[model samples]
Target: MHRTDNRHAPGASHNPRASQTHSGGSDTGHQSPGHQGAGHQARSVEAHRESVRELLADLAGTGRTEQLPLREALGRGLAADITAPVDLPPFANSQMDGFAVRSTDIPDGGTDLRVVAPIPAGAVAAPLQPGTAAPIMTGAMIPPGADAVVPIEKAVPDSFPRPGSTASVRLPATENGMYVRTAGSDVRAGEPALAGGTNLGPGQLGLLAALGITQVTVHRNLKVLLATTGDEVVEPGSPLEPGKIYDANGTLLEAAMRQAGLEVLRAAISTDNPEELTAMLRKHAPAVDLIVTTGGVSKGAYEVVRQAAGGQDIEFLHVAMQPGGPQGIGKFDGVPFVGFPGNPVSCLVSFEMFLRPVLSALFGAPAPRPAIRARLAEPVESPAGKHQVRRGTVLPDGTVRLEGGPGSHLVHALANSNALIHLPAGTSALAAGAEVEVWTL
Candidate 1:
């Protein structure tokens, strides 16, 4: 693993079931004081990303492995190099349903040769006499003395003669090794088929199946503790009160984590009470690889996560980015903790920008989303000092049409969007047709 200046490895490896906290993080003993102050300084998006990467540089994966069947290995990372146990196409075979012949037997125009017994698939064949032709099916083993195959369509008198008849068939001149699949031509035994850290996709799995691999060793899924907070938030299946609404952040964040190949354990909604929040954290934090909570990091009186985490080493601060400015990051009880803003869209955006990249860097399985250049379909204004991430739809003509405004509460618009238009901190406005960076959602 590549080491950054600020990153520190988890001092010791812990078993998956161990509840003890592994020591990790920077050895510098201090971070900039601005990280804990009330909007003292606006931090760049890249700075926050570096902080995340520092935490993930050592926690790349759990370093555990499991054996899974080929069908279950889809999307999993290979644990070790896979070497071919047997040569592909273990024997020479015919490439067409034609006649197998010696290249020496063909005359200048054509020659009628005695037709011997036919060789169907899955059976051994008799050796060809010097002046005889043997009928062979596609994929059937080539006879010992035959060096080439003449397609049935190209045979003179162009069809197979009767089985019991003493008919001699004519074939045109052919070169040696024509239309024959040679043994070991694809992959030789003991050759490496795939390297470690490769993501198992359809093609990779197919190759393993073709090589007769029944089981594979893969890395274990990442274990995460997911929590949601807010007094006004209620679970989805419950009845809604006058001022409370169904909670969307929990389900949204859970789905995103799972889609990124994480094993998530979502806790019940943590209300505005600090004691309840702290209790939930202490109960679940030590047992998981990482802890993530939605809401309760912004500047509000009911910020339960920030208040409860005060005694711990967690820091609450603002990032110079739209939709997900108020954030919290640090270690709690020796486990990495991330606090996202409460709004539905804010929570989702934070995961995409920070957690997703960290996961990609760690496991190397789920690839990063593609970034493309697209023209703006209409005029749009951005804040002077913050990077704006706006939901949008990419038109067929390579233009982006933004959805709702920049407010973090626009969950409906977020659901309808398929792309995100990124306006850097220095960009204030863009006219129609201006090229912009678009990240597919």
Candidate 2:
């Protein structure tokens, strides 16, 4: 997205300087000759994570809010505190299908009162006469001067008389306010209904509906520009060409971003040419708040992303982590940019480790994954200097076993796993039954 570099366009001749390998070391499971001489030191996983966090720090607290229909606001964060516009129920109402009467009309033992008329739900009735009871249905507005309700079962006949028919029913003495829902009892008018930052779920939307709110103001979803690189990459459903594979990183990262409540604008696949990649980025940079690309950040000679990022503010570097170590974090055309490694497992793991947490902390979406302590089912060894993240199935007995070996391309194994086994850097080996920290996927 570097506008100053017209040399990195689609049809421009390749620059000799771009042929030189990037300084970001490599993710080939072994130190490369380029990394040894490039003077780029590999940063720890936490350091790289912090770099990504700081790069996109401006996304937090932007105070941007949008009014959305209540149905569409599900799972969105509330932008402001919501107060009830009117009291719940709005008026005193019946809580049972019974007769409304003045509590003092009945004596200590019992009394017979004349049934004046029936009051179904939503009906307005006149005040109760001295010794008369009005048959009322559940949720019917309580008539004026009615202090209590006598359930139909408590009456002598245990049922209401025919409509407009004069009849007498025996009832027991009742206390004032019995079986009556008073106005503002649940929530008063102008009272705080839901606080800011609340996640709008089914219960929250139901409350808003009860408060007569058809829409809500919530934080706007963050927009992201996602791109994937490599000439060998092709979209799924197309005829497979020689040495070509379906593009998994684009779909994988796009789904992950959407799960985090991010609106994604996925760019077309970029070829090995740095010029075309740079041109694609330039075209999409203005519409998104952040840009994420997969592949082309390693020490390989055909690393188009690294080549295109040359002389730009973006920095390509290595993180001390297994499966997903090569990373790029900085700004592209004033928009935050993050470049993840090419391998499907690595790309997904990169999002889980770095981007997911930052999004949760910043925008309060995609609730954090559950991390727990589990015992190792078998002994395992890891690289001496890098953090190893292995796919595992956490068994019911609190023991976890590896799903597959520590390979960045093991997508099948990743699919069978239910959790990520986090083995910190510097821990070369661990024995069976040893407790380790695990994040449930």
Candidate 3:
């Protein structure tokens, strides 16, 4: 999905009030006089993404490593190449509950052998006598001098031979190494078990456990400082006063970052006071690798993020996209900062379009979601110049239906949707059955 197709759009609209300083969202394709011409910078989605990629390449993945217990290492990035200390399975073992015997000892036409001992799953068995067989359970070590095994089902009696009483298990003829899992058959000792940058998911963790590895080296989770700014926003549990909305961006972004494998520290809501917001950033700036603040980067008079961080290296811009155009990106006090619009839907969209991809490229922490080409189930109109991002549900018939309007405040609609439908720039409308790019959320 690292594509740079100008025709493909993100499908969300920016608040017109937020982009008044530059070009409005409706003028996404228009070239303004002062910003146009030879000195004009490319403001396309791909250009902005390239800048983000450059910033991440310089800031993330510091090549640092930490040793953590296996239990705590799941979903982390493996920091170094790992070589197995011992062969997989370490020793020749049975692949099933069966009888272990030397192939040469079996009768030429296949017959029963005197059963000497029964080896349970964990026990080490005495060497099998030349003419006798040992009852071996799956994963039990193959006794010495035995090169073949006949599964219990293949035995003529199809049952376990007694441990001490005289008995024999009939088995059909078997090759020399039948049903015997040899040591090093999976992976040899001193060979690579996992490469650097591997994400330690369930299967990867199981491999380490199989190797008896209790501790592993991995990249420490990136610590992020998350803040939300707005005077009208309040915590969810608090009683909602007139004209006040519960702060959802803080919780939304925090959960998204945590799910992507970052350690998040949520700060208290920042009121629309520049000085107080500025102080909050200064206090937590040094403690985290990245700083993310939602709300207050727009052109509104009370936009504390712009008032407080305007003098910093951050650049506030109207990306040629919908529902999330007001964006701020830069470094403050040597820490990376990303400011998103206050709308719940916009906050989530900004994170998915920009931050998530950067984390995936830098740390190999999040596996990218699959994107599919889906036909539109209904007609929809979009602005001519911006890529529009709409929340929708993909149907069983391979079509997608829009969930809500282009407004950024439609949080409920977003919750009901499972995909983001993309409408490319320059394309104003599409009818049903028109193919569009859809990103699974």
Local accuracy of candidate 1 as per-residue lDDT tens digits, 268-293: 98887889889999999878978898
User: Candidate 3 on 82-194: residue-level lDDT in tens?
Assistant: 89989998999999898999998877688878888788887877888898888899999999999999899988898985568898777788889999999999888999999
After superposition, the stretches of candidate 3 with alpha carbons farther than 4 Å from their true spots are 1-50, 58-64, 103-109, 126-132, 231-244, 298-303, 366-387, 394-401, 421-441
Model 1: per-residue Cα lDDT at residue 269: 86
Name the TM-score of candidate 2.
Answer: 0.71
Model 1 scores a TM of: 0.76
Superior candidate under lDDT, 1 versus 3: 3
**By descending lDDT, how would the candidates be arranged?**
2, 3, 1
TM-score versus the correct structure, for each prediction: 0.76, 0.71, 0.80
Segments of candidate 2 deviating more than 4 angstroms? 1-54, 60-64, 99-116, 128-133, 146-157, 168-179, 237-243, 298-303, 316-323, 364-406, 416-441
Query: What TM-score should be assigned to candidate 3?
Result: 0.80
lDDT of 2: 0.80
lDDT by candidate, in order shown: 0.77, 0.80, 0.77
